[model samples]
Structures are given as structure tokens and as C-alpha cells.
Target: MGVCTSQNVQEKIDNIEDDYLKLDFNRFSTYQKLENIANNIAKQQQVDTIFSSLIQRMIASGQGHILKILENIDNQKKLGFMTKLERLDFEFIDSLFHHCYKQNQIDAFQCNVIQSTNCQEQNFDLIKEHKVGIVFLCGGRSSRLSDKLLSDIGLPSKKCVIQIMMERLKKILMLSSENKEINDYPIAIVLSDQNQEKFQMYLKSQRDFGFQSINFILEKSLPVIDCKGQVVFEQETQAIMTPEGTGTIFLQINSFINKFPNMEYIHFLGLDNLVGLPLDPQMLNLISKQKADVLCKVIETNSILDDRIFYSNRQFKTMDEQDSNITENSYNSTQMLLNDLYLSVSFLNNLKYNHEKALKLNQRYHYIKRGSNIQFEKHIQDIIEVTDITILHQTEDYALLIDDPRKAVIQLSNVHKRYLKLEGTQEEDLVEITPQMSYCGEDLRKFENVSYPLII
Candidate 1:
């Protein structure tokens, strides 16, 4: 079936009677029947205008091809599938093509480091009094982390990435309980639809990791566009889609913040980091003491893969200058790097405001080629260009991000050893397991608490 043409749309519009009779209360006393009559009349008049505007907007944004694809599906069915708000979301994505970041437009500045040990008891006291929340960005597929969360790396009991993180959260909560001022801290996990069910089940199996309340924020998935600028179909009815990037944390958690009006600070981190402390009091203290809107924990870039964290040290470039440097990878010259971000509710509000405004503008969309398909992704770090960010330098080992299976196994083993030492456990009691040792499908339930020796 072809899309409704202008004539077809006009016919529907022409059929709507402007002088339709208003209901008389005595003639139709039943409220339900009256409501149905009014709704049918309103829907008939509004459908043409709503759909015509949607199609025109898509055409204006160079997405006319999408309209053709959408026509092949049932028109009413497709419209019913997406709410008016959801349609606006697709429009916002289209605007990204016009208002993208130009590499040369950004300025970088080296940030200074503040040692965690330097924090005082007074700072900790303030942190205990502050109402803070933790957001775990766990939306990414563990494709790079061995594709299985349960890849065991020699633990006392066999545990996966999620299990270890749950344990870590339990410890943080336990520590928080020691403080009288701190009560009812909420932890939210931001997950994608693909992983939400599995993750929830896993959490339930782990008994909620002893946390009284754990909220979930599901990330919205945007449809993928092909080289021809047409939406790619995953199935007959569904479109191929990917999760909007980590920067989406601002929008996803906005409602959660509204619920807890007193939530002043949010500490967010990625899921791959096994050693990350959920609500590090030092970080909380730094943000509170500095009176900063955003406090980013940064480490000097030692590896090529690490993005340089930079302060906005220069003025906004002129339109002419921006146009001249709009070539491929032009922004790679900037030297500063970013680690992770801790945002205040005020900062989140600012981000939300900017994002809402940006959607109205004609923004450029940047696409990356992933093998045969192209992907559109944005980063939380990109906010540095627009927002004033305060940076605190920490060691690279503050948290370890697991990307490779073998390397992560080695790193997890080392982290485990360090954890044992931190607990004042002697090395002699450790029962080291070789790298060659596998679960072997045997009844190895007896191996619990048997620490495997380092693979060095």
C-alpha cells in the first residue's frame, strides 16, 4: 500500500464537518455514549492533520524515504505503534544530522588531580549528610566482555560481573548504614530493553543483593538508518535499533530525580568496571565542597584508546573557522581526556534543557561504520564542550574497565588478591588455581572459598 497522497489527505480533511451539532445534555444523558461520539468526531478531524504534519516534518528533514518505508506497513497500525511523544523522538534524532559537534570547535585544558587520601573527616561528614543517588550505566551489551556475564575469573565463589557489582553495592550500603545521617539512598541501574529481563531475573536470583530498593531506568532505542538514509528493518514489523548513548543518562533519570526531589547529587559509572565503589564519599565531598555542577573523575591518558580529558579553555569558533576544519577526525588534536562524571540535579536539569532545545535546531548527524552497518552514537564526554566541568585527577587504577576476556580475567584475579590483602588475609591461606583450570562441568561445589593463586 502506498502512502496517503496530498489528495487523499485533503479528502479526509474535507470530510470533517465544522458545523457538527453539539450534544444536548437532555438528548444524551449517558456519559459513556457521549464520550464515544465526541472522541470519534475529534479523532476523525485530528488524524489527517496529525499524520500530514508528521509526513511533512519528515520530508523537511530529508527523511522522505522513511515515509515510503512506513507506508508499506499498515498506516493506522504504524501510527498506533508510536505515540505523539515517540514521533517527536524520531524527529529529534533526525535533527542530529544538522547540529553535530565539529572537532575544531572544542578546546582542551589539562585538569589538576586531587588525591582521595587528601579528603578530610569534615568532607566525609558533609557527604553523609547530603542526599545522593547512584546510577549504574549497564545498558551496553557485554559483547566485548566475553559475551557472558558469568565468565568466572577465580573468585571465592564463582561469580559473574553482575554478581560482583551486586556484592560491591551491598558493601557500600553496609558502610553507609554505619552513618546515622545517611538514610534511604537509592541506586538506579540504567539498562536497555534487551538486557532488562535477564538482569532483573539475575538480580532476583541474587536476592536483590541486600538492597532495600533498586530502581531501573530502561534506555530508549533509536532506529538505525542505512546508507540510503532509510530505516533498516530488523523483522517484518520492527526496525533495527540501537541504544542512545551514555549521555542519555540525563534524560532517562530525570523522572527518577523528580520522584526524589531532595536528590542533590548523582554518581554514575559504567558496569564493566569491577572495582568501582558505588557512592565514593570522596567524590561526593569534592562535588559538594567545590559547589560544582559537574565533577568529573579524570585520569591522565596513558593508553591510545583513552580519550583525553580537556577543559574548555578557548572561545567558541566562528562559523567560518568551524566550516574550514569540518573534515574527518579534525577533533583528534585535542589533548585532555575524560574519565567518568558525577552530576548534580541542577547539572542534569541544564543538560535536559540544552538537549530539548537542540532537538529543535537543524543538527548534523554523525554516523560510524561498524562493519557493514552504520551506527549513530553520542558520548557523555561531549558535554564538556558546552558545560563548565571541574576535573579531579585520580589514578588509572581507581577503576578497571574490562574490554578483553583474557586481560579482564588477569585483572579480576589481581583485584581479588588486593581485596584479600585489604581484608588482612594472609597469602598462605590462598589456594591458587592455574589459568588452565576450568569449571570442567564437575561437581565443584566444594571449591568455594578456595582462593586461586595468581596466574603470574
Candidate 2:
């Protein structure tokens, strides 16, 4: 008798296939299939003894899907991105595989709702009392928008989305100074390695957009894998690496907080949302009064409660593919206000732990294609099982996510008019409203008499 091994099992499978014509078809039985499966499991255990880690344990303990993939990679001796297994960064991809193979389970919790009508308007005093931070998620590539960075997408004023957002921040700073809160707002921009250089070059050209200091958080870029779990390469020399996901932003939350010890809340803004108002005055007042730990700005589709999706007890789920149960009436704007004090290191670690443990059952996986390769991603909104959430019902005017050139022109123009409040201006008017002129729709009546094509 010979000692069994994965290599031996592979040879056996090959031999069986090679001799298929010689075998008696009626001799095959369920007992033989069960015997082969048991043998493979034993061989996997022997192979896993070489490494000590949860990742290895997962391959050994679970069905031999991952083990089979690795075996095929080894036999081929040529991965698309790299030539050998030793060249791969196993440690870096440990979590990726851990998440890819596990069953995801999101615990349900209750939610608290806050109506827009009940929220106090313009509570500047409350904002001045606490320290706040802004996190701009801009790691995304232009994708359908174009080859240009999403931050560089032009608005009606000839200013890009990044410029507009910075101007809005500058206005907040000015308001804080007027209220005697002179501390500079700690702002962080999450960027991927692919776009970091370009973004920095743009910022340098604009003199950091007049900011005294800005903190930049670089997101982890991982190699894209194909359907067969082989790394995909863009060209002959380089492997294509893509930004992990929006949820990966949470990994840096603790470090960002440590830098700004006094930050009480963080306003999350998405790069695609051209009209998002970070640290909104009304939102600030509602969260402050209610002392809610998490705030999700949602849009209601109908007046009926049963027809709408509510974040009851924090059990509300994001509209991701993983969520089988979806109510179409209401959805989130992807903007959120998170209480910094509520986000401790242990709490975030626990979330990460649970995220890795929770997996899709029945061995199902979802993949998205990017250009020439496919990748997996986990969204932040999908795993937000916070203790309590305050849902702010807002109009769709606040949820304009620009993804196409045609939509950008029409939607941005309409939002500009709404914010500027130039009543007499026609729908086709090219109104340019800068943050210096008005922070947020504050008595912009002066622009009413300006002209058909007014630039403020």
C-alpha cells in the first residue's frame, strides 16, 4: 500500500478519465463516489498540515473547491499575473479568500426614524459645539462617466466636483470661524493607488485647493481574479489591481480618529454624488438632539409605511445583490453621519470579525467585471448593523449620483437652480453658484436680476 497524497489523488482522477472507455459503466456506484470523496478529504488534511492559519484551515475543512483551484494553479505553473505561487502575497489575500469562501450573516437590529419636518433648520450653534470630520470616498475610477477622474467631472460653473466639494468645506470653515470655532476641520480623502498620483498632481496644480492641510488615506488595491480564481493581468508586465470596496474604508477609521482625538462625528460623502451636502446643518441638529449613533439619509417613495423600506431597529439592508428581500419604495442616498464616540476600536474590529464570518450560503459567489477582469467587493452599507439609526427622509433632489455625461449636464443644472433659488431664471439658464456666494441656498435672491447666463 502507498501513502495517499493530493498528487496521488490527482493522478488517480487522471487515470480514471484516461481509462473511461475500458471501465464497466454499470460497476460505478454511490459507494465508490463516497469513497473517492473521503479519500480527497483525507489528502486535503495531509496537505493543510504544512500551514497554520484560518485560511489554510478553511481549505482543509470545507469542500475541496479552494484546494482544487490552488492545485490547478500549481500544475499550470503560470498564473496570468505572476509566474509562480511563491510570488503571490498570500498574507495580503488572506482576508479576501476568507471572505470569498465564508457564509455571510448580517444580524438584524431595530431602527429609529427622524422626519425632515421635525429636524431643526440651520442649527449652527450645535455644530460649533462639537468637533467633526469629513471623509470623501473618491477611490472609484471614472468607469461609465469617462476616462477622466470622477472628481474632475465639470459642473455648470466650470468647477469640477472636487472643487465644489472643497468650496463647500471652505464655507463651513468660514462659518465655524465666525462662531469662534477656529479649529480646522479634519478632512480625509480615500484614494486608490491607481488614482492617487493623478489626484495629488491635480491638487498641486490648484495649490492644495487653498487648504492648509489635508489627510489622504490610500485604499488597498488587490489583484483582480477570474472565474477560475486565477489572477488577471492587464498587460504582459503588470497585474490589474482594483480598489477593494467602500467597506474597506472602515479599516482606516480608527487611525483617522486617533489623529483627531476630539472628532465627535464623521460625515461620509460619496464622490459620485455631485449634490451631497456634508455636515448638513439640519442633519446635524437632528442627530445632536436625538443622540443617534448612526444617521442614514433616505428617500421615501410613498406615503404608506407598509410600502416603504424603513430601517426599523437597524435591520434595514442596503440594496446590494446579497439582499434577497428589497422594498423598492425607499432607498439610501449613501451619505451618512456616524458618531465618532460610538465607533471604538473594539466595535470596528467586531464588525470586521463578523463580516469575515458571515458568508453567502450554498457555495454561491457574485463577481463583477471591470474592463478586462472580474473582481469581488463588499459594501460598507451592507454590513452597517449599528445599534441605532436615525433615518432622515429627504427629496430625490439630494440623491443625484452622476454616472453619465448626459445626466451630469441636465441633473447638475437643475440642482444648481434649486439651490441658488433664482426664481426668474429659465430652465435653460446657465447659472453658476459658487460656495463663496452662498453656502447653501441662503437668500440667493440677489442673483435673480443678474442675467440669463449669470456667473457668481
Candidate 3:
């Protein structure tokens, strides 16, 4: 008898076709069919040793009945033959199916709901004492914003969105620190593969904005899956792929958390919202005091049309009352959780587990087509149902979230206009409209007093 080497087994497996196996299964006995399929899978995938060992153990333990069930199903026909990377991708999608839950079913606990008006000195003090981290979700393709991140919004400094954010961080640390030296809190900038190099160069040119420590977590890209459920290759060697969205931060922050033992809560913000205070003391204080697992910041819309969707008792719904004169009521404006949140090392660890589970179960995988390629992505808010969440509301006038490029331009123009007015200078004279220079107003509002700061 010849010894069955991996090379020989692989050659045999490769010769076996799906149609041949299907026909063989119908004609063979259960045990024969099981043995053939297992051998093929093991041989082609280079897992013959593990597969054989498991089968032998199962047979020795009188659990061979399991093999009978395996014979009735065709693994290749159902799952398709996958490469190592493809297998990993499928496993991740499978886990998502288990963790996915209905977003509307999340329970909103209202105990000790913290408000901007109620935030006091004690809360600020608590915020200063607690160790909190900020995760900036900035590495997106920015295709909607013309592939530039607020590059058109700054003055002579020509600061990009990241530079503006770093400046804000410096201000927060300055205010919170007792000593003159700035306290370097852990900051994780989650970037996509495309933006990682460019953003790093930008930060280096600016001297990291006086930040003592910053961690850049570049998100991993997965192969694009076609309608036939096969990996789509862009070139002969390269597969078409995309970054897995903001939720990927949950997977990338483990090392950051490990390095900063004092870090308790994580605040997530998008780069577009220049006025957002990443480390707002009052918000941090609220999260700490309430012992909430998740915190969502929202603003009440002026009318039903403004708030097409609203949350009632933790359930999200479209406003049935469409009267233009409806009384003052809070409604959901954008799916973007501006000033969105997650917490404590323990909570994050758990979130990571749930996130992976959701991915494996196919719960959060949103399949969409980008031109000729198919992409799988997940939103950060998809995890809300699986988490304990609390919503903090602000008035619509006080909140600003930029979703459109035109709106962003208008908002920044308003800021520039306000700056000219405040400085007692006409835009025609003091402000230069050169192609190279653009100006956004300085942020003057005290962080503790506002939900979303008004830039002036």
C-alpha cells in the first residue's frame, strides 16, 4: 500500500469536480460519501492531518453518526471552495448573523438623564479626574466631500480636518490639566488604508499638534464579494476591497486600551463636525455617573419634517404627526450618532466580542454595490441594540452635522462670515479670497456650557 502524502492527496482532490461529487454521493453509502468529501476538503485545503485525526477520534469514541449527516450534505456545493483569506471572510460574516439584533428594539434607560443645563462644576471635576480616550473615525474615503477632509475650511494655517481636531484636543487638555504640562490622553485615529499614509504625513508636518501620544489604527480591508459569492480581483494579483467602516475601530483599539490602563471611556466623533468637543467634560461626567454602557448625543428637531425619525422609550420610529405647527418635540435627524459613545475597557472588550459575533452571524454586514464591485460594510450604530444605550438630547439650533458638501460649504462660509463680523473687519478687505487660503471662524464657546459649540 502506498503512503498517502499531502501532495498526492491534493492532486486527487483537485481532479474531483463538483458534479462528480454530487453524482458519487447519490450512488454511494453514507459512510463512503462522508469519507470521500472529508478527504477532498482536507486534501485541497492542506488540512488532511487535522481532518483525519478528528475523524479517527470520532470513530474511536462511537460518534461516527455525525459523519453520516456530513455525507448527506456537500460542503463545496454549499460553502464553495475558498482560499484561506476567503475562509476567514466567510467566518466573519457567519459570526455577524448571530450578533445582529433589531436596532429599534434597544431599551433606553432614562434614569439620571444628564442635560447640558444640569451639568455643573462637580461634573467637570469628575471628568478631569476620570481617564477617558477619544477615537476619531477619520480614515474614510471622503468620496462625498470630494476626497478632501475639510481641506477647504481653514485660514492661513490651511489646517485640514485632522489639524483642527488636534487643536481642539490641545485646548481640552489645557483646560483640564492642573499642571502647566498637557496631560496626554490616549487617542486612537482609525484610518482606512487609502488615508493612512496621507494623514500620517499631514500630522507629522504639523508636529502632531502638541500631542504627547497618538495611536493610528489602520483598518484592514476585505476582498469584495461578487453576486456569485466569489472574491473579485481588481488585478491579476490584487483583490478589490474596502475598509470595514467605523465599527472596525472596536477591533483595532485593544492595544490602545492595554497601553492606557487608566482609560475608561471612549468617545467617537467624525472629522466633518469641526465644532464637536471630543473630550467634553459634561458628557464624560454623565457617562461615568450613569454607569451607562453606551451614550448617544442627539438634538430635538424644530418640526416633524426636520425629525423624520424619533426615539420613543428607546425605540426609533418615523414621526406620525406631520403637522407643520406641531409642538416642540425631539426627533432623529441623521443616523449619524454625533458625539456617539462606548465605554470602559471591560465594555469595549465585550463590544468587540459582540461585534465579531454580529459579523459572523451576518447581522451587521450591509452589502452594497460600488460601481462594478460589491462591498460589505457595517455602521457603528448597528451595535446599539446589543448594547445598553442612553440618548442625550439638545435643541436643533444648538446641533450641526454636515452631511452634504454644499451644506458644509455654507456652514463654513457662515463661520467665516461670523469671524469677520467679530473682528470688526469687512470680508472684502481683511479676508483674502485667494485660491490657496480659506478661513473658518475660531471656536469661542466654553466646552462645559454647550452640547454642540457654536463656532464664532
Q: Estimate TM-scores for all models.
A: 0.60, 0.63, 0.59
Indicate whether candidate 1 or candidate 2 has the larger lDDT: 2
TM-score-wise, the better of 1 and 3 is 1
Write one digit per residue (lDDT tens) for candidate 3, span 211-233. 77779887776656554344564
Candidate 1 off by > 4 Å: 1-94, 98-130, 141-157, 179-183, 235-238, 302-339, 346-368, 385-389, 398-403, 414-451, 454-456
**Model 3 worst lDDT run, 10 consecutive residues:** 432-441
Top-scoring candidate (TM-score): 2
Q: Please provide, for model 1 over 1-69, each residue's C-alpha lDDT reduced to its tens digit, 9 standing for 90 to 100.
A: 786675674454334222122334455453444444334433543433445545434443445444434
Error of 1 at 90 (Å): 5.7
For model 1 the TM-score comes to 0.60
lDDT of 1 at 47: 38
91 in model 1: Cα distance from truth in Å?
4.6
Output the lDDT of residue 61, model 1.
Answer: 44
